[model samples]
Target: MTIAWASFTPWLALSGGVLIGLSATLLWLGMGRIAGISGIAGSLFSLKAASGDRAWRWLFLIGLIAGAFIVHLLTGGLFEVRSGYPIWLLVGGALLVGIGTRMGSGCTSGHGVCGLARLSMRGLVATLTFMGTAFVTVFVIRHLLGFGGSA
Candidate 1:
């Protein structure tokens, strides 16, 4: 494998990472809630949840979408996201991710970032499992199945 140095934007990546961390930190400090996408989204589907309980979750999701739009506006369509997978494949992948997050109790933002920051053992284990699974899956798909470049 070769590095695509021309396409790499370390500064932008670093800034995004910093922003994510800061947002997670602020959410924890201000709201005392984990920045877990699954948990936040799932709460809205619960019939037992009060309207007040659902408000923040709705806002958080809305903010996420709005933030992407704001970024697109600010950058003048600079960010280009490309995918070779068909719509069915993309949908399937999303479904798998949702299942995985449900099974794992939290998503990457929760376990990998906030959980680890709090030094929770479960977070460490979850993060390891997530990373290991990703590594193995990528290796199998790319090398074993010979589906590297086409993807």
Candidate 2:
């Protein structure tokens, strides 16, 4: 039950959380849209999406990548490429996440942040389900199977 003290960065984590919250709030207030990455990305290429809608989605997605790149550049490569996982496992996990997001109707940003902010019951259920599943998965991987270490 030891904390990963060396990896802990509370202030940076808090700043990131605040930035996420602020960005989500701004997107909601300015455009009346939930800042859900899955929803934005999923519908980006849909035939039913309007040209304007697609434009914004593209810009949003670009901004996300650009933001991370800018931070990496500014920090002189503070971020590192993750290693140690098989390509098959990574792809499988990504596929599962995509499927889960579709089944859940939203992601953490939508359900946990915006939905909860609006006091929606569905959001609470979705967030709880997501957290519960994550907890069990991590426990099983790290304790039971003993394969999750800094990966």
Candidate 3:
């Protein structure tokens, strides 16, 4: 187990975590809503919701995309933006994530961050399952299957 110390930026990681936490906190306090990306996105398609409900979701998604662009501009091509995965794998992974988020009733931002902060048992269980599954998947793929160096 070796740390990639050359690429490690603890300060940046901490600041990003703090920013996410703060934004989640603010969203909760201001709107009495959890800042779960999947929930917010899924709700946009709800026929039961009021017409006015979709605006915030759209804005939130737009802001997320725009923020990535902003970061790219600020970093000035220093970042490695591409994942080395094949397109089919990326698409499959995305579909799986969408399905998982739907089945779990929340994504990582929702369950791991907001739900845990609110002390919900569902959040704890979901987060544990997510982390455990990720650990097992990585172990199987990298150690057992010997695909570690490919990606």
Total backbone collisions for each predicted model: 0, 0, 0
Q: What's the residue-level lDDT of 67 in candidate 1?
A: 97
- Expressed as tens digits, the lDDT of each residue in 1-151 for candidate 1 is 7888998999999999999999898888998988988878866765668888888999999999999899899989876677674675568778999888877888888899888989999999999998998899888876887664544
Q: Write the per-residue lDDT of candidate 2 for residues 1-151, one digit (tens) a residue.
A: 7889998999999999999999998898999989998888888745788887898888989999999899988989866678887776678878998989877888999899888989999999999999999899888877888774743
> How well does model 3 score by local distance difference test?
0.85
Looking at model 2, how many pairs of residues clash? 0
Q: TM-score: which is higher, 1 or 3?
A: 3
Q: Write the per-residue lDDT of candidate 3 for residues 1-151, one digit (tens) a residue.
A: 7788999989988988898998898888988888999999878755566778888888888988898799879989656666565676568778989889988899899999988988999999999999999899878877887764543
Stretches > 4 Å off in candidate 2: none
List per-prediction Cα lDDT, in the order shown.
0.85, 0.87, 0.85
Ranking of models by TM-score = 2, 3, 1
Instruction: List candidate 1 segments past 4 Å from native.
Output: 146-151
* Number of the predicted model whose TM-score against the real structure is largest: 2
What lDDT score is found at residue 129 in candidate 1? 92
- The residue pairs in collision within model 3 are none
